[model samples]
Target: MKLIGSSTSPYVRKVRIVMAEKKLDYRFDEESPWTQDSKVSESNPLGKVPCLVMEGGEAVFDSRVIVEYLDTLSPVGKLIPSTGRERVEVKTWESLADGVIDAGVLARLEATWPDRKESERSQAWIDRQTGKIRLGLAAMSRGLGDKPYCSGIHMSLSDIAVGCALAWLAFRFPEIDWRTDYPNLARLHDKLMQRASFAETQPR
Candidate 1:
């Protein structure tokens, strides 16, 4: 398998962390979708990063799909529950984390699109996305409370997703001090950072 993505993408980092945790081996093909010469579109129609090309030449795009499929390949460390409400809860946490990341990405694009004129950039759009990020963080903090992991005692995909989102925020938007506003989340992020999977895959 070959994992194609840039080191800076939080979604790509999430997939990488999962593969590391599962003890899976794959080639990392570093490519940025934003670049003019990028081949990301060949693997993913949407031209997104983290496109996984299997040995047989089959392509799996989307970070969520790739991680779930990778989890089924090996039982080294199951991140998502196989069935029942537990699965739903873990997936829900993942959704919240991804939502925050989605908002942040949109906001960043609005602020930094090179071709757009200052007059063309809408601060309202950026503000709206940032609003989503703030709300999503609050909800995540409430859901986490004092749990060692996002879902429970064991580390799930939820923790990985949340950690990636928080890390990305810190990387791209240092002005948003999530660590101070949510100490419990800060504690969780700190703990997650200690793991080799998280430490080695920190967003560039």
Candidate 2:
């Protein structure tokens, strides 16, 4: 199997972290969809990164799908719950984390346009995204409190999703100062990073 993506993408990093945590053996094909030479379009119709190519030429796109599939590979350290309300909770957290990344990515992409005038850009949209992030942080912090993980006592996909999103926000938008406002989130991130999987899969 092979994972195709860039090192800078948080989504790709999440999948990489899951792969490391599960000790899954797979080659990484470093390719950014933004690059003209990237083969991401061939692998995924959406032309997105973090596409997992199976040995049988099957391609799995989207970070969430890839990570969920990876989790099934190992029964020992399941990142996602198998059934019931527990599964919904994990998926909900993952959605929240992914929304953070989505907002950041959208803002970043809009800012990249050479013709984009600062005044012409929708400040309201940016503010709305920022608000979502802030709300997400507060909610997560409250839910996490002193817990070591997001869903429960043990680490799960929710932790990985939230951690990766937080890490990316810190990396690209340090001015946000999330650590200052959300101590529990900071603590969660600190504890999650102590794991070897997270350490090795940090975004470059």
Candidate 3:
């Protein structure tokens, strides 16, 4: 099997964390879809990454699908509940985390228009996305409350998704100062960082 993605992508980090938690080893092919001649299109028709190519030549992708598939590979550290409302809760957490990252990614792209003057940089668009990130963080902190993990006592896909997103923000948009704004999130991010899966895959 082979895992494909850029090192800094939060979505790719989610899939990598799951594989690491499951103790599954596979070849890593670093390919950002944005680059010319990138092989991501071959594995994923959508031309995005975190694509997992199995030995049989089939590719599983985007981050959510890949993590769900990896979770079933071993029962050792199941990140998602198999049934009941618990499953829905975990999935909801994932959606929130992923959505926040999506907003951040959008803001990042829009803010990078080098040719655009500062006054023409669409501050409104950037503010909208950043506002979403902050609101999402607030929701995550509330959901985590006094719990040790994102969804109850056990670490799940919820934890992985939120952790990756927060870490990516720290990497790309350090000026945003999210950690200080949400103390609970800061604590959870610190706790998740202690895990080998998260430690080894820290964004470059």
Predicted structure with the largest lDDT when compared to the true one: 1
| TM-score result, candidate 2 | 0.94
Q: Which candidate is the best by TM-score?
A: 1
For model 3, the run of ten residues with the poorest summed lDDT: 113-122
Error of 3 at 101 (Å): 0.4
Candidate 1 deviant stretches above 4 angstroms: none
| Per-residue lDDT value at 61 in model 1 | 93
Residues 1-204 of candidate 1 have per-residue lDDT tens digits of: 999999999999999999999999999999999999999999999999899999999999999999999999998999999999999999999999999999999999999989889889999999999999999999999999988899999999999999999999999999999999999999999999999999999976
Clash totals, every prediction: 0, 0, 0
Superposed by TM-score, candidate 2 places the C-alpha of residue 166 at a distance from the truth, in angstroms, of 0.8
- Candidate 3, 182: how far from true, in Å? 1.1
Question: Which of the two candidates, 1 or 2, achieves a greater TM-score against the reference?
Answer: 1
Question: Per-model C-alpha lDDT, please?
Answer: 0.96, 0.88, 0.90
Residue-level lDDT of model 3, residues 72-137, one tens digit each, is 988888889999999999999999999999999889888985667777778899999999998998
Whole-structure CA lDDT of model 1: 0.96
